[model samples]
Target: MATKPEGTQATRETEAELARFFARYEPAIMKLGQALRAKLRQRLAGLFEIVYLYERQGSLVLTYSPTERGFEGLCSLALEADGVKLHFGRGAELAKADPGKLLQGRGKTVRHVELRSVADYERPEIEALLVAALQLGNVRPEAGAKGATILKAEEQKQRAARRPTAARTTAARTTAARGAKKAKKARS
Candidate 1:
C-alpha cells in the first residue's frame, strides 16, 4: 500500500475536529456556516491564510491572516445560531469611507455584518469592504503558505458550566454521595 503523504493525518484530525464542532449546531445553521466558509475561502484563495479558531465564547471562527499565528487578523467568519458573520478587524479605520454603512459595531476597531444567506457574499459593497479591510490590515500572504490551517482547539471553562450534561453529571455525583452517606448511617 502507498504510504500516506506527510501531514495527512494531521489534516484529517483537523477536519474531524471541525466537523465535531459544527455538529453542535442545528442542521440549518451548520449549512449556512459551511457555505459562508466556502465563499470566503474562494474569495481569498491564494491571498491569505485561513486559520480555524475555537473561541472561548463557543464560536468556531475562521480568521484570515497574512502569516500563520499572526498577531492580528484581517477578517473573520464567526459561525452563529442564526447564520454567520463577517468581522473586519480594522473597521474603525474604514468607518469614515463606509458609504454603505453595512458594518455594524461601535467598538474602537472591529466591525461586523451578519450574513444570513449566500447572496450576501456576492454583494459588491461587501467585497469592497473586505478589500479595504485587507489593505488597511496590510495582510499579504507569504510565499508557499498553505491555504488554511486549523489551530489547536480551545475549550472554555464557562462553556462547561453552561452545558446540560455537566449539570446532570454534578447532580448525579451529589445524589450518589448523599445516598452513600445515608447507607453508612443505616449500617452504623
Candidate 2:
C-alpha cells in the first residue's frame, strides 16, 4: 500500500478544514444575508456593486451616487469563515458620524444598510447594522491591517491628480486616471 506525503496530505486536510468551516457557517451566513436583503435593497436600490467570495478572497462592495453628506460609498462587510475575520469600517464610521445613532462596537462587525444625508447617518441605520450584527451573533472578526497598501495606492493617485498638466498638449490637460497594478509581480 502507498501513502501520500505529509505535505500533500496536509493540503488536502486544509481544504477539508475550509470546506467544513463553510459548511458550518453556511446556514447562518445565508440567513444573515437574507435578513439584511430588504435593508440593503432599500439603501442600495439603484447602485453598482461587486461581490466576491472565496475561501481566501471575500468581499461585498457597493459603489453608489454620492449623497449630500459626501459619503462616496461603503466597504460593507468582508468575512472569511476559515479565519472568522470580519471587518467593521462601514458601521464604525456610521456610529462616529451621529451621536446616539451609529452602533457602538469596533471588534464586532456591522454591515452598511443605508445612506445618510445628514452629517451623520441616522439612528435607523445604526439599528439596522446592529440587527445584522445580532444575526451574525458573537463572531470575532480577524484583526489585520490590510488598508495600508490601499492607502499607498490612493496616495499615489492623488499625488498624480494634483500635478499640473502640461501646457502644450490637450491630452495632458485631461484628467483621466486608470488603475495600474503591474500585471507581473516582478516588474524587472
Candidate 3:
C-alpha cells in the first residue's frame, strides 16, 4: 500500500483545524479577523517573519519574530472573544513613553491594544508603537525575508466550553422575539 506523504497529511489536518476554529465565531468576528490579518500583514511586510499559532484556549496568534527560534517576539496579533488585539511583547517597558495611553495590561513585559473596529488600524499612534517595539526588540528584516511565513499550525484536544454570558443570551432572545413579532404583524 502506498502511504501518503507526511507533509500532505499535516497540511490537510491544519486546514481542517483552522476551519473548525473559525466556525465557532460569529460572522462579524470572522470578518474582523480577516481585516486585521490583512492589515497587519501589510504593515509588517518585508520585515519580521509572521507565524500563526492556534492555542488550546481558542485563540489564534500571529507572531512576528526576527529569527525562526530566538528570544521573545516583537509583536503579535491575537484573535479572541470576538475581537482582535495587537500585542507588544515588551509593552510594559514602553508604557512610560506611550502618549496615546492605548496599551492595556499590567504584565511585566507585555501590553496590548484591543481593536474594536477596523478604524483602529489607521491610528497614527499604532504605527508609532509598532516601530518602537521593533526597535526595542532589535529586530531587523532578514536579507531576503519579504513576507509572512506560517511555521506551525495545529489544534489541541477539545474541552468543554462555557456558554455565552447571560446578558448576551438575553439580548439574543429579545432580538429573536422582535423579529418574530414583526413577521406576524406583516402577515396580518
Model 2 lDDT per residue over 34-111, tens place: 344334435443322222233224422222222211133333433334222223335554454445443445444343
Clashing residue pairs in candidate 1 (N, C-alpha, C atoms within 3 angstroms) = none
Error of model 1, residue 14, in angstroms: 0.8
> How do all models score by TM-score?
0.69, 0.32, 0.64
Worst 10 residues of 2 by lDDT: 144-153
User: Over the full model, what C-alpha lDDT does candidate 1 score relative to the true structure?
Assistant: 0.70
* Candidate achieving the largest lDDT: 1
CA RMSD, predictions in order: 8.5, 18.6, 13.8
How many angstroms is residue 178 displaced in model 1 relative to the true structure, after the best TM-score fit? 36
Put down candidate 1 lDDT per residue, 37-83, tens digits, no spaces: 77776666544434444444557777776655434777888886666
Question: Which residues of candidate 2, in runs, are more than 4 Å off?
Answer: 1-24, 57-72, 79-95, 101-188
Candidate 1: stretches off by over 4 Å: 1-7, 47-56, 140-145, 155-188
Q: Distance from true position, residue 69, model 1, in Å? A: 2.9
lDDT of 3 at 22: 57
